[model samples]
Target: MQPLIDEARTFPARAAAHGVNLGPHTTSATPQAMFIACSDAHVVPALITGSRPGDLYELRTYGGRISPYTEHEPTSEAQTIEHAVDVLCVTDIIVCGHSRCGVIDALHPDSEAAPFHLAAGHWHTLMQFDALSAYPCVQARLSDRTLRLHAWFYDIDAGTTARYDPRASTFLPL
Candidate 1:
């Protein structure tokens, strides 16, 4: 914690040295995409995507699970998804799951998938997509073919990402 505090204290100088100017990052954000990942600290959307400050709007959930959208009783996840789709008008949505995640293990303890492997995380990633698609805003954008949804798996140990290919019905290296 002390190290983190020290890093934060020196971030301004480091950011300036790295040519990261914060002046243009206004309060309003128009991100290119909405990235949903696990709440695990190891899975950082910005770092994983090499994204600048506001390039990605992020929503994190345990095991990257998205609660099904209930029209009569909307959840915070639904509201955030609505804002990203309808207000921000983001063109893409990505749901990412990472290896070595305890969330996945707890969600499916009976599964035969090797513990903490990317394959073990596949089920939940797809489940999140299924829930995300149930959102009205996502449905509208998808119906108009103006928005794209992607499921990705990250190997924590290897520092590599894989994207699910609908055509192949398999996860492929990205």
Candidate 2:
């Protein structure tokens, strides 16, 4: 922890020396796109998109699921989406899934054993992929054409990326 903290403490000076200035962005925030990606340490949206600081509004979740919005009890995910769209006015929303995903593996219907060694608990709710497209906020945004939704899959082992094509209902190489 100390080593990581020490490195973090030195990062500002190192970044400054390399001409990385975050001062301008500190006063204002205007990200062009909203990137919803898996909460995998290896799958960094900024690194993947070659984006600089404040270039992307990121929303990371297990399995990259865009959970359905519930008005009675709005989730953090829903709130983030609302802010990204209503406030930031981001035009693009990308949901990126990855290969060797533990969440996906856990949600697999054919798996004989439990995905995790621990208790199921809230993890069971993560299996609801069918409800992803039914989120009210997503529907509204799509209907109004204010935002364009994208689905992507990243293969870690192969170092490949595939984009979902709705017309053909298939994922094609990008």
Candidate 3:
């Protein structure tokens, strides 16, 4: 805890160096892409894409799951999509899932059941299904037509990536 607290103390220094290190991003930020990735600390969009600040609008989820866009009620997924498309006018939206995901394994029938925090349980419920389907809930959400949604598999071990081809229903080397 002390170590983390010590790291937190560097915030001001980092903030002060923002203009020096991130000077190019000093202007208004209007990202051209919306990156929906896993919340895992291992996966950082800026680091992975070699992008600096304000280049990408990111939404990180436990399983990098995408909720379908709907007009019924105000939802975080809906709001994020609307803002990214209408407000930011982002051209592309990427949904990336990482390898060896505990969340995905938890949803697997063969995997052992373990207690998760309330938020994790709720997020899992969004992907839980009553019937056996080839694709997960997130895949189903990407099937929507309004926005061009892409699913990617990021392998941390091999440092390789694969993109899901919905038409082929497979992950191809990227």
Predicted structure 2, TM vs. truth:
0.78
lDDT of 2 at 42: 79
Q: Which ranges in model 3 have alpha carbons more than 4 Å from their true place?
A: 1-28, 109-148, 166-169
Q: Better model by TM-score, 1 or 2? A: 1
Clashing pairs for predicted structure model 2, backbone only: none
Candidate achieving the largest TM-score: 1
lDDT of predicted model 1: 0.87
* Candidate 2: count of backbone clashes, pairs at least 3 residues apart or interchain: 0
Whole-model lDDT values for every prediction: 0.87, 0.71, 0.60
lDDT of 2 by residue, 8-95 (tens): 9999898798777757555466897988877888788987887877889998888677676688998898888888877888888777
Q: Which RMSD values do the candidates have, in order?
A: 2.3, 5.5, 7.7
Candidate with the larger lDDT of 1 and 3: 1
The TM-scores, one per candidate, come to 0.90, 0.78, 0.63
Candidate 2 regions exceeding 4 Å error are 26-29, 108-133
Q: Taking the tens digit of each residue's C-alpha lDDT, what string does model 3 give over 1-174?
A: 998898789865775676525345544567867887778888878777767567788987776665554447655855665677667766567767676566756665353443333234333432321111122333343455444555566766677777766677566787
Per-residue C-alpha lDDT of model 1 across residues 8-71, encoded as one tens digit per residue: 9999899899877777666566898999998998899999999977799999988887889888
Residue 47, candidate 2: C-alpha displacement in angstroms: 0.7
Off by over 4 Å in 1: 24-29, 107-117
Cα misplacement distance, residue 167 of candidate 2 (Å): 2.3
Overall local distance difference test of candidate 2: 0.71
